[model samples]
Target: MPLGADHLIHANVVCSDFERSLDFYTRLLGARVIGEVFEFDAGEDFMTILGVTGGARCRAALLTWSDDDTATYLDLLAFADGGGHAARTAKDTGLARLGLRVRDLAAALAWIEEHGVPVVGGPVTLTPMPGRQRHVVTIRDPDGTLLTLMEFPERR
Candidate 1:
């Protein structure tokens, strides 16, 4: 028998500044805020949950790219006492980046450039098969979290 894992709920990104990161996601990726930003103090429950001691607090909100209720969400969270830094490189391992599939890479790039967001990597073409092609680029958020935008050839 195999463990029944259905789907990914959300990936949490610990931001240095919650509002800035939220704004970046909304403005650049068109992520809509699902609800109000809330904060809570972490007691023994959070300590066990996050593997930390007492006195940890968090500010958080869920963001979605679409209006579907079952859609996966981006959980943007920040800690009151957290002073951690982001992963320096994708090779550093855990939660490297969030990859989003877009319909138009050119339009996305244009909007990103117009907003003064630097493109860290290519809009390079990837041709795995004769008819299959993918265009990709990498950009960072306000907290330097890598986001990969990929556009694939439309299917018939």
Candidate 2:
């Protein structure tokens, strides 16, 4: 068999408040709630995998939406105990920010600004890989995680 599959299934990020994160994902990112799981009576190792304790209250919601027939999902998790975590900033950490290719950079930046989020970078032009022109803008989420919105027009 090959080392791995050709496509990614999903990505998960920890949140201090699952409900609030769920609301952000649904309202801000336009994702739909798919499912949720609570691990209560599971074994110690299983609980650890779920980031919970034996008698802890853990909530996980799967939110998803489709873009061009591709399913984009977000896993919102919260633990009643001190097991929950927060998103980290891309500049301070080694993680690369999430990049979203959008249809309009200006409109996206306006929407982000309307939501009270500040733009970290510009809606300037750039030469993408190879020989294409692209416009990009960066914005920070409520938790300071960076997200880049890229726009590639039909002709520039």
Best by TM-score: 1
TM-score of 1: 0.90
Q: On residues 70-141, what C-alpha lDDT tens digit does candidate 1 reach at each position?
A: 689988988889777845667877778889988899999999999999999998998878978889999988
Q: Which window of 10 residues has the lowest lDDT sum in candidate 2? A: 34-43
Q: Give one digit per residue, the lDDT tens place, for model 2 in 8-96.
A: 65676656766676676677766776745454433588668867557556677766666433576655666666453455665565665
Local distance difference test, each candidate: 0.85, 0.68
Clashing pairs in 1: none
TM-scores, each model vs. reference: 0.90, 0.73
Off by over 4 Å in 1: 128-130
User: Model 2 residue 115 lDDT?
Assistant: 83
- Cα RMSD (Å) per model? 1.8, 3.7
